[model samples]
Target: MFKKLSIGRDGADAQARGAGAEQRALDYLRRQGLRLVARNYRVARGPSARGGEVDLILWARDGTLVFVEVRARERDAHGGAAASVTRAKQRKVIFAATCFLRALAEIPPCRFDVVAIDGDRVEWLQGAFDVPAEH
Candidate 1:
């Protein structure tokens, strides 16, 4: 689940903040033993596509493909970082994952993960949400 962060409407700033958070999450995950495969993976399925971007894609030590959604909040005024991952966001990640796998030789086991950062603290949620269907 996402923490429903309160982000500004300013797209560029939001992206900068998102990139920073993703870097933090990536570093932390690397320390935890996940191998970085892709960062900021995006694919467009066109006009009616549910496609979007995936913050970080990691390969678990045991071969699981990890799709991570990175969230961060400067303050907990809204609901913290985990509160931001809405169903729509999850769907977008899923769609992007599908596009990524289409180029793979074989699809492996995978899970959706959330890395929530509040203030200076970071919390990693494994299997935060089930991998959504491509359709």
Candidate 2:
């Protein structure tokens, strides 16, 4: 993966870079034949509680509902961009997916995906995570 881009100071710059990464990921997925269903789909459980969000919700050619999380890093270090998707992040994405599914009459085969952008290079990982099994 490429590793030369420098994100500017402040939260806004990081947000802009994140949005750019998402756009790049969306374009790549579109080229791969995935239709966009939603972008930045979000939900909140309560007024005081943290919410969930899915970066991109897409429909694969085979009819799978794909929930994608787009991540970016200036350099691949300490496990890189893909490894940045931690368990807490996965839970938020999963929670958002559940909320999204509730609106559908029939649940389709679903998957969690990651679009990790390391500088200028991008990688798409299918089934990047799953709903954690209960104890």
Candidate 3:
């Protein structure tokens, strides 16, 4: 099944591009005074009841934990890359975040953020979504 959904070259290319975009976004966030905490945090194991991952985790000056989703697109001809984070995706992020917090002896206030990189422009959406109840 994993082989069936393999992204192949295109997927690899997209991942590289996304990584570049994420680095830029992280730099921008740091310039704005947000402290960097973690990156590419994986929570799941495999595809089936497996594991999942979070793109970035950050810390605010006020002690807020930020889970960031970095998205990039050449243009918004469709809904743009930011729109790709659907409700289901948000849930996954929330779940992963919960797991991250649980592993910590101290949990802090946190929120979901989405950074959209459209060409040369980067837009940051803070508190993009609420954590799901089950998490």
Provide the lowest-lDDT 10-residue window in model 2. 42-51
Candidates in order, TM-scores: namely 0.86, 0.89, 0.86
Clash count in backbone of candidate 1: 11
Q: What is the lDDT of residue 131 in candidate 1?
A: 63
Which candidate wins on lDDT?
Answer: 2
CA lDDT of every candidate: 0.90, 0.93, 0.84
True-structure RMSD for candidate 1: 6.9
Candidate 1's TM-score reads 0.86
lDDT per residue (tens digit) for residues 1-135 in model 2: 998876667788778988999999999999999999999999977663768999999999999999999999999997889999999899889888988999999999999999999988899999998898860
- For 1-135, candidate 3 gives per-residue lDDT tens digits of 355665556877878887898899999899878998899888865454745568889998889999999888898858887888888788778767877889999988988999998888899999888876765
lDDT of 3 at 74: 90
Model 1 C-alpha lDDT per residue in residues 12-125, reported as the tens digit of each score: 888898889999999999999999999999987788855688999999999999999999999976789998899889888888888899999999998899999998999999
- Worst 10-residue stretch by lDDT in candidate 1? 126-135
What's the lDDT for candidate 3?
0.84
Model 2 clashing residue pairs (backbone): none
